[model samples]
Target: MPHSPMEVTRLTATDAARAARVLDEMRASTLGGGRAKLAPRPAIRESWGRMLHNGIDPDHDFRTDLLSRDEVERRRQTSRLRHTLPVLREGLLSLADTAQHIMLVADADGRVLWREGSASVLRKADGQGLGVGADWREETVGTNGIGTPLVSRRPVQVYSSEHFVRALHSWTCTGAPITDPRDGSLLGVVDVSGPLETLHPCTLALVDSVAKLAQARLRDLHLTSLEQLRAVAAPVLARMDGRAVAVDKNGWTAAVTGMPYTNRLALPKSLAPGRCWLPALGLCSVEPLPGGWLIHPTGDPEPPLTAPHILLDVSHPRRWTVTVSGQTGSWTHELTPRHAELLYLLALHRDGRSASTLADDMFGDPARTVTVRAEMSRVRRYLGAFLDHRPYRFTEGAEVEVLLPEAPLDLLPHSVAPGVVRARAAAGGQAWVERAQR
Candidate 1:
């Protein structure tokens, strides 16, 4: 437990044997409740708690049903991870093949989407149920690299008995989470794994660096998309007379005229040529352009509004609902999980959150403003006059409340947003104390 799993010094043969013995003792103590006096490292112990709570059997090797070949193909086609594969392969596969290790890429749900490397290693992997379509989630397979890193939001290495399931003790693996640059949501995991003899302390650093490269590539892709949108916006803005701006489908500002440039503007859910109230520009006429929408300000002033009450419901796993009530009555909008996390964070800091602060909260990186701006623009579209921005906030006088899941751990289960993670941890701690008292 002295060194983190990722920092375990390159193991000498003697060190490796000792570490193996210690981990084996920890596992025996955990599974049999015997007073085998050894403790797992903090990270592994924490992962073990989650695995036990999730009902994974320590003695059993469990593999959930694999996705159908058609289903697997569909996920690959739609996954943002598709863009990261080349980076992962270039960075890890070559090295892995030489070391007789296998490379694996799994989606956010921990289903292996791609596997490659030494043909012999791959064939060996099949016997351990580590082929494409295999489910490697901690709940199903016990603590290991792929699923554990997703939970920890950091790179991890599981060596020998550090694995929760007894049958996986012969394997050692290192993995890192690949996150979407736009929203910081986990896209999937990139892993290199092999027999115990192949364990290398440097594997964690290699996978971590490659994961970052994938995110950078995603950022480059986003910039390219914006460039294409800007080209489409140029001709449309040339003929405009009033204050106007052109924005892509996601509301990224591509071009602006007759007004100060804003990073982004919120657009209505269904984009059509029509008059709609815009939070940033008051009332505007929205017109369809080639790759985006052109907005022309009508110079109409926004009507004064009474204070409103806002309620965010994040109790459900797959659906998030937001409702606003004001002098004009109440309206509700279903939110995507990403939007729900943003609104919850904003509500937590009602004074308002700047784009950078929100970016940090959502993605764990303050510099990721493009994604934050784009998502906030969409939130504004739905919330309308009830929301305000400079630093984004609910309009003054609005009372905001968030409805959480019944169990703290159930709250936004798939969200890795920093604020959400803190909230979940706080709630979980309180829940545990309550149970202990009972």
Candidate 2:
């Protein structure tokens, strides 16, 4: 009979060799369809299940082709993580080098964009095919620090034999995911990795704390940009006549006149200078500002007479969006992960869901109604009258459409919401499961 699972972090440095041996036995027993004397840690076990479901080979060290150098440069230039490089380097590089580990940052798509730290470990990582431009997604490469945290959306450490791939048993890695604070969009993950002997209990916390600092730096930069936009908006809005507001490209409000101050405006994906219909502001004349847009209410600020059409697209694993069309015009808004989950759940349960019900669907905890309500309020700002409360649902008269991924496993890959998990499970793991069995 197998003993209860052991958390790798609890092991002392002197127990490193023993811990690896035990984990090895646990992994072998689990993978070979036989029970052993030990069980894997919760995160490792869950990650291993995903790996098996996806048909990943535990013995074979599979890796996708490295991205071209030019493509790597292009991604680095465009990634939001580029802006926080200084913060990450300052916080992690020195410690990583001293500990003989390497610090690497992978984009939301799991492509490594930045790498630095101990010279010797860098060479070893190169041998492991973990250099810049490498793909580290869990499906591509068996569960490891970089890819696992991206899916789990939390800090994680894969120590020695805890790694899903058998060849990775000699290494250890700790990583934490970083997200955009403004809208809760995942940016990427920061990871510190080295030979198994260097594994330390504190590494996970250190990586997580530095990742938060990077997020704080990004937030500060956003605030500074908003301040600059506000400076330009104040003067222009002061001269406007009727109800108007100044908002950034992402719909963050900077100034308002003749109307209540809104924190955000929900701009369309392809907004331009002209007459446009906004959910919150209705028919309006839009003019380009320095770093944002100026809006003046034109016709009635009320919704159109006919019912609107809403299309919720969750086909892509990483990006989700909602498009709304009415008699006046059409607009699409990119959704944050949490908003995506709520909208998806509402779309699934067209009859409507109470705050507690939504909480249960999202978090598997009905007591989290306060959090559900807070998120729903933000969703309503852009959705406007199209979404109704007191049992949140789309308006009775509106048309709703949902676009799901072809493969069940691809549906919201980052989401572990109980509802989404159940939906995916209903598909019986689809193609990947078949591929793995073969």
TM-score of 2: 0.90
Instruction: Give stretches of model 2 more than 4 Å off.
Output: 1-6, 36-39, 301-307, 429-438
Task: Please give each candidate's TM-score.
Answer: 0.75, 0.90
Q: By summed lDDT, which 10 consecutive residues of candidate 2 come out lowest? A: 429-438
Candidate 1: tens digits of C-alpha lDDT, residues 1-438: 533333334451237776776668657775554544544555576577566556677788565677999999999999999998899899999878888899999998899999999899898888766779999887788888998887666788888898999888878889998877654557789989887776666677888999999899998997888788788888767877878898876667888989998776655445569876655676788888777788898987666666678899988644578876665345566576688888889888889999998998999999999999988877776685677787898888888888987656557665778888788777662343233223
lDDT of 2 by residue, 62-126 (tens): 56789999999999999899998999999999888888999999999999999999999999888
Residue 265 in candidate 2, Cα distance off native in Å = 1.5
Task: List the lowest-lDDT window of 10 residues for candidate 1.
Answer: 429-438
lDDT of 1 at 153: 67
Q: Counting only residues 3 or more apart in sequence or on different chains, how many pairs clash (N, Cα, C under 3 Å) in candidate 1?
A: 0
